[model samples]
Target: MIEYVARSGPPEAMNCPAFICDACRQQVVGAGIVTWATTIGDGRSRTHSQSPLYVAHKGECGRKVEAMLHAGYPASDGWIDLWDDIGDFLKQLTHNATNAFTDDADGEYHQHRLEGASTNGRMQ
Candidate 1:
């Protein structure tokens, strides 16, 4: 029988990281954050967790982050900006919110699960 190794905890950050977060609209701070980026068109997608970038969401926030990805982010001002902030950083992300739903949009959140996902080294 083939044995599988199960991992735990969040993945480590990498160099040349591209952050894609949901800048909290409530306070000056954001929450439920998962910032990462991978090599484009490498014939494979890797999440910081060492799993597929499209790994299923474990909580409400993780799920929302996934949906935002599906919507897409367009580059502007010669900047491939994907950063979002609630306080003074909000301006940086406004350019990507034309037809896309704002981070504070309705249904953008999900319920958190205690535990379940376990792959490579993340919650999968």
Candidate 2:
């Protein structure tokens, strides 16, 4: 499944060396959004596969991603079931961004940490 996450930090400290916004095709220097996927196994056990990260700017670019997804844009490999709970995802994204903050001192950007909601309706 596809998921959205809000993160903030120095660009160099992110999981990727550089986050290229999938929507605007620009480098994300600070607070930005990330989309990835998680795979679960049967009840006996569970596993996860890391899908290609889809990063985007937190506000407008983030909205663009939502629009593309709604219009049936092709998702990354292993993200075949993106429509499962998109409405909820959009809510989470909007809430997170709306509540996020910025850091101007020393060029560090800080955004509020908002966890994604799991399929079970709990924060993940």
Candidate 3:
């Protein structure tokens, strides 16, 4: 299974860093966040695979990742599949990020989850 984690600070040199913001498509300079994916095997003799790190600006752009997760893009696991439309995906991420706080404040997010769970415990 692959899991992604975000950490404070720029990516280390050993990770073959690229200073590009995955969400905003901007060059990342100081005080950035690094997002990387790790794949671990399920068996006793587990193997691990690390993907190249994704860097993003610490503010709005970085928050898109959190928002995308809240919106449940990759419902199961692994990296987010952008499919063929990267532009559309970015737009969705931005929209979700922009509405994240407002949705939470209005309790709409929780209500939506409750409705979904009551209807079916699976992604429709």
For model 1, the superposed segments whose C-alpha errors exceed 4 Å read 1-24, 27-32, 41-58, 73-124
The pairs that clash in candidate 2 are: none
> In lDDT terms, how accurate is model 2?
0.48
Q: How far is candidate 3 from the true structure (C-alpha RMSD, Å)?
A: 16.3
Least accurate 10 contiguous residues by lDDT in model 3: 109-118
Using all chains and alpha carbons, the TM-scores for the candidates as numbered come to 0.21, 0.35, 0.35
lDDT of each: 0.32, 0.48, 0.45
Candidate 2 C-alpha lDDT tens digits along 6-121: 45686633343455676877776656766544343332443333334356677898777655543342344323322223344557768768665453344433222222434553
Question: Model 2: runs farther than 4 Å from truth?
Answer: 1-16, 37-51, 69-124
For candidate 3, lDDT tens digit of each residue in 9-92? 555433333456667766565566665444444434544433333455767876774454335434355434222123443566
lDDT, candidate 1, at 70:
34
Per-residue lDDT for 105 in model 3?
A: 67
Candidate 2, residue 4: the lDDT equals 37
Worst-scoring 10-residue span by lDDT in model 1: 47-56
Q: Model 3, stretches more than 4 Å misplaced?
A: 1-18, 41-44, 66-75, 78-124
lDDT of each residue in 26-53, candidate 1, tens digit only: 2112433333222222223421111122
